[model samples]
Target: MVPRVPSPRRPRLPSGRAADAALAAVVLVLVAVGSLRSLIGERQESWETTALAWALLVAACAALYACRRHPVPTATFVLAATIAYYLVSAYDGPLLVAFVVALYTVAAEGRLRMAILLAALGLLLTGAGTLLGNHDVNGVALFMMTGWLVGVVALGWVRENRLALAREAEQRAASEERLRIARELHDVVGHHISLINVQSAAALRRLRKDPEGGPERAEEALGAIKDASREALRELRTTLGVLRQVDESAPTAPVAGLDRLGDLAAAARRTGLDVRVSTDGERRRLPAEVDLAAYRIVQESLTNVTRHAQATAVTVRTEHGPRHLTVEVTDNGRGPIPLGGGSGSGITGMRERARALGGELTTGPTLNGGFTVRATLPCPAAPLAHLPGPGSAMANGEPPRP
Candidate 1:
């Protein structure tokens, strides 16, 4: 037959002091019941005999109460008292109950080796007392002792299993939270930085072309600032939506790519900078990530030219092929490359974008007394079949003559 599962005992309050009080009261009532039975002529037992029995019962119950707070000490006390009582008289109900409770507590909460040692000691003492008291070696005593040992072992196993399950649940919850945070950072932070890099380059180009066109160039710069700030706000809202129960949709805008290079050039033109864009090879559709990376590299390079190059004209050229897409932004400006200025986060941001797209980017002085930024991006073999027509080239795939 399957053993019935025991209910989990209520946890004792403040070192089991309250549980001890309750156990003490129950023990007194049991003693009173036995005493009253003897007094009412319920049996032929003598007054002294009845009084001794009540005293042993009360002592055993008191030890059981204290066991919750001090398992080892209380178990020791119960063992000694029960053995003494058995030697004087014989085995009884109260003594058995107290001993069993003490054994279970020690096995569940005490160190495993210590609990085993204590159980061995208790068994030895019980056997010795029974032999000395002339109690018969019967099957009943053996059965009772076996049952107590089984109960102790089972209680310890159940407690360990419960603790293990709780720990596993906690770890799973922490892992899920980390994944959610990573997704939010990637989606929101990456988008805004791309927009900022694009607009800044456009402003710098206008400043170089028409040195006297200060008012118009300032207006273009202000517009770029407004567009970037608005994009940042929208990205922030999308990230915050994750915490709310309602499902707010992400904003849909045209993904910046090669098709939009004219608008990019126009923004620079508004700043009084003469900028030209040219393309070659088939303008086939590209992966969204690859397209975004190419656009940002060109944007950041041109932005740098407008800010630092101080040149009259800038050129952006794109070449698509079966194996790769190449982008080059060059300017005939007479300024040294500012590697140590710490004036901007633009260059670091550009490198991060290219790395994200599985591509390489390089920026430095060109051989013809100008600055050039070049990136070679790998493309899929199949998409090269659909490259754009010849008419799509910016300035027919050639830089404007200085």
Candidate 2:
């Protein structure tokens, strides 16, 4: 069974406290004015009765200040005040608006069940008083009030759902970006570091075997190590630059693509591995995401060979079809091939990259005592007919030259 992960705690709305206070103040002023005007219609009532009704109205609207923080409690208080005001006053006023706002706040705070219970209780009491001839409100007014309360509850619930969905979307985007960064770091650092280790070890072995004669071979190994380290630093800086981007400015480093396969192969060859790259179909410019994915897959496959496969030679093949681009890395190594999609083998990450681009990746032992990683990536052919003629100073939506 899949384990349930709890949703993150909901963050407060922007300027939530200030906004809540402002809403309460506005409602209080409106309710006070409307209720005083309503009381003028019943001039025969005593001064004490008028004062009590006004107090209840103020209390109902004032309770809304804490509605967001204590939604259920505030809603209950507001409901009681509204009911008391209607019972004592000769006529109805806009005091019910305070109760409506309170009910909406309760539901918006994710207290749907509590809000519904309070609303039902208020409606029941109002209906009972009307039936007993204690309330001046008629049947039609009670029914209309019921409908308005129901709508307020529904609106609040909808707002809560929308906020929840937006939060989930943001979290998912952040998670995907983190995973992408990890894969880039693994490919960039892992390959070069493995090559450095191999070259350094070889140099040490040579010097131990023959002190004077081994110096020449050791020097060659050291040179390879220097090249590997330099390349690693360059790639590391590029990845870091992308990470440090805080605005919409252009990236400081260029993205790696298939055009750099020659350099990659040469680096692998320096570690005494015979690396060959072959292309079958006509190569064309690919989407940035597809190109990056293809490069990382090949880079990771070779890194696995250098670390696990005790092979002397490896072949990297690329086949560009009309709608898909295929990359295959094969090594004639006697070492064990990872049969499972484990994190250690980086097969999971590679598969994720392929799937992200609506593609698939497969890894298994080759027929002739070898291991191969094959990935097929979906790449739509660029439209050539829509291009501007050669004399145009821009291409692919780029700005024109000065």
Count clashes in each candidate, considering only residues at least 3 apart in sequence or on different chains: 10, 0
For model 2, the stretches where C-alpha displacement exceeds 4 angstroms are: 1-14, 38-42, 247-254, 335-345, 383-402
For residues 1-402, what per-residue lDDT tens digits would candidate 1 score against the true structure?
Answer: 999999999975643577667766665676455446445644555667656866776777677776756777877777676666555543343455566666766666644555566677777776765666645544478568766766685786577567768778888878756654553454344444544555566566666776678558756666866765675676566556655647666548555577667656765564456787777776777787778678777776766666667777888888887778888888889655555864565556666666656778887887878888888888774555554432343423344455
For each candidate, give its TM-score against the true structure. Answer: 0.44, 0.86
Of the candidates shown, which would achieve the greatest lDDT relative to the real structure? 2
Which ranges of candidate 1 are over 4 A from the true structure?
1-74, 77-91, 134-137, 182-402
lDDT (Cα, tens digit) per residue for candidate 2, span 262-283: 6677778878898877776666
Task: Output the number of the TM-score-best candidate.
Answer: 2
**lDDT (C-alpha) at residue 382 in model 1:** 58
